[model samples]
Target: MSYTIPFPRTALLAALGVACLAAGGARADAVPAAQRPVGEVTMSVGPVTRTTAQGLPEMVRRGTPILPGDRLDTADGGHLHIRFIDGALVSIRPGSRMLVEDYKYDPQRVSASLVRFKLEYGVARAISGAAAEGARERFRLNTPLVAIGVRGTDFVVRAGELTTRAAVNQGAIVMAPFGADCTAQALGPCGSSSAKLLSADMGQLQVEFRPQLAQPEIKPLQGAVFATNSTPENGSTVVAARSVAAAPAPAAPALGRTDSERLATAALADGAVTAAISGQAAAPVPPPAVTPPPVVITPPPEPPPVVAVPEPTIPLPPPVLAWGRWAGVAAGDGDIALPRAEAADGRSVTVGNAQYNLYRASDGQTELARGLGSYQFALDKSAAQYSLAGSVSPATVEQGRLLLDFGNARFATDLRVANALTGAVGISGAGAIRGDGIFFDRSVAGQAIAGAAALDGKSAGYFFEKAVGAGTLSGITLWSRP
Candidate 1:
């Protein structure tokens, strides 16, 4: 005689889910060696698939490895949640296709990390991780018409061929159209008068970009606007006929276990995997208690005398260009999008870096007057990069001082690049100042540092690119007279 045991419907479905995930892991060996795993699918529902870098397509389930250059596609009602190696999270909505353009993360040198994603079509939500926080300047998400840059952000994007929509869940983003001023080749955010700056403080407002326009328009985010469609082909439309999947059922505790723990037990019979999805670590078990012996207290040490040192004060000569970093903005976001240069008190009417209207401000009218003092580097407002063959990490800049002699019509600057990988690399350059306030490195192997002073004489800035072995070290600085 043979006996058959009955299984619950929910348990049966969970078992199948577990088996599908296991199969996905087993196929990992087929991926090429050069294409390493950048993330993993922690949760997947319905018809989800991934197209590999080599153009291989397969069904994706929970536990599937997400490789660089992989394209993820979801059918109607399909959903996917991924956790990247650097702790970033991405949620792909139904009827969506997202491509992981590039992802490079090094735990030891997170500043060198680069993360890029392209939302081919549909909607996706992204949460910044260590890679983004460590090197916000290197993170980018591209759409058909616009490129989005972030400074430690959590955001959502809906992409279409003609239009792109972006909303910030946390932090802020700089959205710019791909044109002569902003290009795909550049990393980090681009700033232009037409660029749109969106932050969570703006409430439920979303930035909408169109291929035909240079500036992005703002719109309210209605609940129905982002809903998934019952019909897969109509998913991208604003109106929704029906929901593809039902909302998850409320949890009912079986024991004293949490909802996640209960689901982990039912799904894979393991809680470790659930921890990754929830972004929570398991609580450590306390050690066994033991009786303590008598303790003896020690006497406190004597305190040392304190002395206050006065800070040095320097007098300002005259106003030329008032050099100051944009208040309340991170250095990674680059320059603020100023509509026009502001002229004040006979100073240079505009202030910006190489990427801005500053280059155009040299219209033969503004002149650099002879000044005695030097402009000091604002370390807090400056940023540098140390680029090796396979990496570009942040470098500490110190001893930054630019000496200017308008009487001699010359300028010189020296700063040290303290890089963990290459140690400290000294950089020193000098060049003749031109009548138009423009200057170029005259030192041999010139152009080590090329920059200009504001015609108003209030501010100055330069761009540096120096070769170090097989790699190059580069950075930009904003200076003010001291």
Candidate 2:
């Protein structure tokens, strides 16, 4: 029933040629809950959901069941594994979310029997471990409206209500409707023979598909920006998505006075919502810095009435230590990998993996940093240089996790725009704000800023815990712009 083909030397080399990545890795995110596989509960929050032995991860909680949205996090080296009630495994990275509506496992045959996950925002890698190709126990994922038919292949989906981006890392993932008869839904040019589903150049909301398009960049029919170069067999076409997932924030938030919070808010601001589900909120703002008052000493009452005790001077909020949110970070990549970054001003710097000589953004001619560890410089209102050093602090929840010295922004760069950093407790990344936008470019030898990832209407929060199962997990390298 299966067939295989051998390739000639020329053909084989040609095939490998196209496989090379021009630059970037993948612009994606992952769901902490639904991304994990079941057999081994890789990650967990609480009682919300679990990756069943043969089930995909599910949305355990939303903001209070219906109020606010809950956020999950991961990094590059991290992934959220989910199990399909039928025995499927899904892996998600740092920035991802899923809304679960219905799922029933028929362990007898190992299938979704019936399964669905609404990828509201972020990225997800789904692998069908058990569901048979043509068997009725099909595994499927839905955006607001359109549906995706996930085969045994490994597919990572980045979705928004109007614009869903589906890229196949290993196998092909077909998009169809929920419960629609596979054969009955005779798509005109269904397979690779039909051509590319769309071109890579298609705008966010205006992607057109053709048979010639490459396999890896095949974005299914969920995003609002889809175009039909050719007609389908169905006389009347179904518009597909009920609504878009979310719109992308502009460029990175500018580094300035407004971005002092902690968490970085993204997603939610990009697409529209379809069904009701719980997910993470925007990154939260950092708690305002509380500087302890200077110690004051009172002199003992002297016998002489003329002798007066001197009062201690309370130093004003050290302009340098007056902490508040700086302007937003440039729209950064969910998979940012920057070398040493020079702060906005020529004199300041922020630390990174690589080393570099940076010219300050605030002043075009000044080279504020060079001979130092990976560091970025910033300028607030001063003639002083502050460095945002990157390092793992033993006393941090995000410890070992990459942390940015936000102070570098104000003192170094002249922000064109900015967003707020949200957080809770001592440190949290939740909430929404505005920003100039930022992103990473993998094309360069040392990955650098390719563009920006604006975070206008998202949020962040910190609920660090392992309530699900495995309490020991290496957080993902997802946001390690490090």
Candidate 3:
């Protein structure tokens, strides 16, 4: 039987959850309750030492609850100045106070990350890697007013008794919508319980010094103001900008120089005053420029809390991919780079000295037609289809375990290949072909697997007519999950 934790996905628990503590409820539930990983996790604080339960590097000693003083850092050199660790680097500036429930990372599984932190009153910066491929690694911030879930790339959080604000800097994220739990059926994306109040409850949450949006962690430009402004007009609030004008020469030095030049040989003959003038003739070398001291930011005694609100209903549009790129070694064999397409009213796209006709057919199949001396070649497919066909014979489908075939050519399909959404390819009276994973051609001789599958083809069992020729696969990069 599957062990499931009775955790609430709603928002009512966002505030005042500290009173509802349970053994392993928050921490373990963050990792699906049942999945416990065996690995080394550390939390480091300050410059000198590392410790546990006390001091800087807190060990998170088994049963002990992580309190206000502890900070965490991981083996991958990730710095966690505050909060939990789900690849979310929470650097709390000064007086921020928060509670950490759990953090887990599993490199083996693409989605084995789960992190949760509850901000009571503080300023926190979160540089995140959330929902990033593996299991259910999520970064959550619990404020006095609401809960903030990051279904996004990166953002910053600041919350307090009077106010809570979360600003997204990169990628996308969402605060589970309010009023979500109003109905027993479903509240859609945001429920009434999911609505979070921002710019509220934050009494003295100053934006100064606290980075609302992130800044690159490099040595900031010295002798210049470290300013940050929202609009181009607000400019940066000068963290520090020092302009030291070159030192001026003493007035006596200039007069003394003119006198010394006049004294010269005559002074030796004439006598004393000339020697005095000569002795005073030198201009003191300007003291070597003092390297300005490193600026230290003394955080406020009290920092604000951070919370997130539901994103707007109309989500942003996706970017368009213009397949105008040409891929081929400078002096080697090459074919059209993939998502192999077919055409309708197409144009000639040149690669090397030759040009291939690219067509976006009305039926959505992409086609590539190129002439090579006596033989004319073409490959056609809708970028979504798992099947493809060449101008040659015997059409091929995805090989399921890993690979795509076209006679003798085999291309790695594990990550490099993307299943097409529409269209088909036909080379007529060819032989048998077999495969899986969105396979639309024939059947595979072996196993078949897909995150999701869709296949349609006919032959003896899969597809068999002529004697299948060669089998080959090529050109694709594997995307890893850690």
Provide backbone clash counts, one per model.
9, 151, 66
Tell me the lDDT of model 1 at 118. 89
State, as a TM-score between 0 and 1, how close model 1 is to the true structure. 0.43
lDDT of each: 0.68, 0.31, 0.31
Model 3 regions more than 4 Å off: 1-87, 130-138, 176-482
Supply the TM-score for candidate 2: 0.26
List, residue by residue over 1-482, the lDDT tens digit for candidate 2.
11111222234233223221111224312423233222232343333342333444455422112111223333334445444334445554444556444443445655335455567655665655444343433555655423566544555555543234554434445553222222322321223211233322332221221111111233233321211122231112445668767987789967765563554565433322322233545444556799999999988886766767799888863111111112233212321122322123222221111112111122222222222122222211111111113321111122222222322321111112111211111211212111222212122121112111112101111111111111111011212122
Root-mean-square deviation of each candidate, in angstroms? 31.7, 33.4, 30.4
Candidate 2 stretches greater than 4 Å from native: 1-40, 44-79, 110-112, 132-137, 176-482
- Name the top TM-score candidate: 1
Identify the superior model by lDDT, candidate 1 or candidate 2: 1
